[model samples]
Target: MSAIDVRALSSVPVEPWRNGGGVTQTLATHGTEWRVSVAQVERDGPYSRFDSIARVSFLLRGKGVTLRHRASVIRLAPLTAVEYDGGTEWDATLVDGPVTALNIMTAAGRYRTTVNPIVVATIVPPGCAAIVIALDSACRYSEPDIGTDGSIQPGQFMIVISVDRPLRVEPAHHGAAPPLIVTIEPVPARTPDSNF
Candidate 1:
């Protein structure tokens, strides 16, 4: 993987849910290993289940949403994220109106995932396997010898690859939705058959 993979916000095909709950747009993916996407929920409905996967999701727009799991419930508000086992059955209830959720799914136990809101200029987590999404304003980045430099347009995203170096992320401008930095690092799961 390269240091940065830039992608503009373009009109991509919308994938409507069979239940007519809403639509979804996949922003980027790395084979079957992991995926980044945005989902818009128009009406309360059940969330899709992904066995053997771990999910970390946050609200991108709208009022907020409530996630109903078997034993507990979760309130998903703007700037807040929720992580849970993807295999769990869950239902969504809109609070005030429809909401858009940004989600990252990675095969369970295969990778370590982190989603952080850009509060200040910071380095891209080591390994450089991350995704940077511009929320309210364009996101800027700088790194020596790195192929990417400039502002990522609002609503756009950059898929970073393996670049073992420091990648700095500037804080979003005032009055803009803070950008998100999602990092995914491979962590091979040990098998019982393997020697200790």
Candidate 2:
């Protein structure tokens, strides 16, 4: 089991010519089965349609963006994630300023994820996975069994632990800042017939 420090995430520019929006990739199929990317939406952009992918977008900074899908419009707020079919028509409108968000996309039938806040002393059950992000500048995490202990500053995110193991979360230390946790689950495997 390994712990991924969110602060260490590398930033890659989002090429609109390629995916219809500006984005920064943290992790993807290159290192893991799922793709994790972050984007900063500055203005109205083209609607994105990914026929074979599933995505969850979490608002990180600013007032957030207005997500338009077909005839539906959803207002996403900081600390909340909106899950939708990647193949559907989707667009965004920045509310007050440039909106920052964490986007997780996985090829269909590959993986799924859950994003939420973790209060201290919470024992994340086995088979449950999570990504923890520090919403402030002084948040810390500790796991006794895994020998994992660290802190996350404001604007930093960590991919806590993979789906292969169980996890536990402790509340932030006194004066510890707020944070967000996201859990991911990989799709089951498909076995091929040897006779083929």
Candidate 3:
């Protein structure tokens, strides 16, 4: 995998949900097993279900959303990532209004996903495959290997392949918030003979 895979916000096409509750822009997907996308919750309603999948979601914008899963009420704020079982029954209540979120879902026992907030301008996590999403403002990112540079605006993101190279992320201007980077690494796949 290359050190950088850039996906512009304008290039990502919007796909509506079957229930018409909201829309999503898919960034990357590995067949039906795993996917990374940005979703907008336009209404306060029940969330879609994906059995046997695990999801890690980060609140990118808007006021907030509280997800009710099983007996837990999880409040998601900006730049915070929350993991939940996709098979669980969950509903979302918008605190202020509509919200935008970065979602990463993986097949159970096949892959593990982590979404972390990037608070400073520095090198990304060492040796980890990840995606960096610009949350508040435009971000200028440069890769040393490819000798390439690009920018992703708010609501835009890019994929970083399995290259442990350093990347410099700079906000378009001062006082702009740092980006939220989501790292999706493959875990040991579970087979019939593999024990937990």
Give TM-scores for every candidate, taking all chains together and pairing residue i with residue i. 0.86, 0.72, 0.79
Stretches of candidate 3 exceeding 4 Å from the true structure: 1-3, 121-127, 138-156, 164-173, 189-196
> Mind giving the per-residue lDDT tens digits that candidate 1 earns over 68-87?
98778878888677888889
Per-residue lDDT tens digits for candidate 3, residues 1-196, read 2556766677888999888889999888767868888899999888899999998888878988988977888788877778888888789899889998888888877776777655556565455566888757677777666586777777677777564666666566656777767776677656799767
> Of the candidates numbered 1 and 3, which has the greater lDDT value?
1
Deviation of model 1 at 134, angstroms: 1.0
Q: lDDT of model 3 at residue 136?
A: 71
- CA lDDT of each prediction against the hidden true structure: 0.80, 0.65, 0.77
Better of 2 and 3 by TM-score: 3
What ranges in model 2 sit over 4 Å off? 1-6, 9-21, 27-32, 146-148, 153-155, 160-165, 174-177, 187-196
Whole-model alpha-carbon lDDT for candidate 3:
0.77
How accurate locally is residue 65 in candidate 2, as Cα lDDT from 0 to 100?
80
**Cα lDDT tens digits for candidate 2, 97-143:** 87778878776777667776655555555564567665554456566
Candidate 3, pairs of clashing residues: none
